[model samples]
Target: MTAADRSARLRGLIAPGLAALVCLAILVGLGVWQLARKGEKEALIARIIERSHAEPPAAPPPFADWDPKADEFRRVRAGGILLHDRETLVHGLAPGEPGRALQGYYVLTPLRREDGTTILINRGFVPTELKDPQSRAAGQVGGETSVTGMLRGSEVRTMFVPESDPARDAWFTREIPAIAAARGLTNVAPYLIEADATPNPGGWPRGGQLRVDLPNNHLQYAFTWFGIAACLVGVFSVFAWRRLHDPMEPGAA
Candidate 1:
């Protein structure tokens, strides 16, 4: 091809080449971001496992010092009277002793601590039939008793999850502040406690059903993005080679 013709052909490829480069860069960046997230998730899983196995602390850190990122999943013991009158049920499901899936509601009661501050304690899951406190009144421990459980933060709701309805007493997730407000409570701790596997008297609200099996799919996502980027490079290389050699094929002017 003539010098001018070759220059024109090269110029035609500029926009497409630049676009491919930008797309590749974005894909690679996403892959790198996922890798970073994988690291953060790994560290989080390690912390959760360690805290789950550790002995319960004498008491949780003061409300003023509560940090979701640092204090979540901590095993703690707090002395208080479970205010069953103000208890609320949150919708949930748990594995039954027979290994069957059991639909239930988590019994969350406000525990009035000795300091007069109130904290929400997740007494644990009760079957759908035992949702009413009256149905399992015997399990409702009154007066003063120490609660031992893991310190947990408010749950993050997804866009698809419906909002909590206090009037209907329907709670899809454990939203601490919202629950406290709905129940007309103040000085409530920012976090909630998942009561340990301690058996209750009535064997109703089965405690210790908390599971920490967080799905770690960041690595898989990272690989997917990286694989796409690699395929893009290979495809682009083939396209570029074909474009460069098109005129050299059998077609002569």
Candidate 2:
């Protein structure tokens, strides 16, 4: 090709070439970000397992020093009188037997401590039929009791989650502030507790509902992003080669 033809072809590629490079940078950045997120998630899981296995403290941390990131998934023992009448059922789906998944609600009852402070304890799952407190009478043991389980932060509602109604007691998300306000609870803890697998009195709402369902798919996502970036490079390479080879082609751009 002549020098003028070469210059014209280079000029034609400038805009589209810059756009492709920008896209490539974004794709590569996403892959790197995902790798970083994978590391964060791994560190979090390891921290949780280690803390969970350790002997739970005699009591949960004081409300004065509540840190969401540090306290997440930490196991702590709480002693209080389980106020069963103020129990809030959060709609959920859980594994019933081995392979069977059943629709149920997580029983979150306020436990009033001797200090007059209250904290929510997710007692565990019960089938749809036992939604009413009257149905699960035996499990409602009223008296001073203590529970050992993982301390959890308030859960955020997603797009798929339904609007929570306090009047109907229909909850889809574990919003601490909202629930406490609705139940007229005072001196409430900033976090809630998911009770361990220790069997309850009537075996109605099973305990140990703590499932670390953190999806570590960042590695897979990184690979996908990188794969897409590589494909884009190949496509741009071919397009450039064709345009430079055939400067007269109308579709080269």
Candidate 3:
């Protein structure tokens, strides 16, 4: 080809090649960002696993200052009586032996401690059929019980659904304050207690559903993002190559 023609073709290649390079760079940046997020998620999972497996920490002082960062998932021991009269049923579904069965509501009762404050206790899982207040009241094991469990934050309200109305004993969502008001509890702690794997006599609501499994699929997600970025790079490379070598090709021109 003539020098003038070659020069013109080279100039024509510059803009499209540069544009593809920019797109490829942006994709690579996004891939790197996703990889970083994956690393963060893995680290968080590790922290959760370590915390869950570690021996329960000593019980904090009653009404003592509780900080989420310092005390979340910390093992605590407390002696309190199960206020069965005020047990609030938290709706849940569990996988059963036979097809998907609605595992009854979580038995969340207030535990009145020696220090005059209340902590919501998730006694355990009960089948939906057995959620009658009368039956649960009848099944109450009297006397003060020593409870070991993990401390959990209260459930937050979502925008779509209306808040739970405790007066009517209706609970569509786990609004702690509303539930507390319905149950007539004062000075309720900001957190709930998930009972440990302790065997309740008579096999009632079984405790120990606090499976601390951390979902760490972030690495896979990061790889997927990176793969997309790699594909983008491949596409960009081909685009650049075509622009540089065959700028005047029928369709390309």
Of 2 and 3, the candidate ranking higher by lDDT: 2
Instruction: Note the Cα lDDT for every prediction shown.
Output: 0.86, 0.89, 0.73
Best by TM-score: 2
Full-model lDDT, candidate 3: 0.73
Report the poorest 10 consecutive residues by lDDT, candidate 1.
Answer: 244-253
> What are the TM-scores, per candidate, against the unseen true structure?
0.91, 0.95, 0.77
**lDDT (C-alpha) at residue 184 in model 1:** 94
Query: What is candidate 2's lDDT per residue for 1-253, written digit by digit as tens?
Result: 8988888888989999999999999999999999999999999988888987989985564476788898778888999899887888899998878998899899999999999999999999999999988888999977899899988889988999998998887899888989999999999999999899988989978998777666899999999999999999999999999888874766546
Ranking by TM-score: 2, 1, 3
Per-residue lDDT tens digits of candidate 1, residues 1-253? 6777667767867988999999999999999999999999889889888988898876663467888889888888999898999998988789866878888899999999888898899988988988778899899897899888888889888898888887787899999998999999988989988899989988867888777788889999999999999999999888777766577633545
Cα deviation at 87, candidate 1, in Å, is 1.0
Best lDDT goes to which candidate? 2
User: TM-score of the candidate numbered 3?
Assistant: 0.77
Off by over 4 Å in 2: 97-99, 251-253
- Predictions ranked by lDDT, top down? 2, 1, 3
**1-253 in candidate 3: lDDT tens per residue?**
5677667767876887688678777767776777787787676566656766677765665467878656667667778888887888887655567776666777888888888888888877778777886654545767898788887776666797566666667676556677788788998887777887787765667677776665666667667767877887787678656655663754743
Name model 3 segments beyond 4 Å from true: 1-58, 61-65, 98-102, 156-174, 247-253
RMSD of each: 2.7, 1.8, 3.9
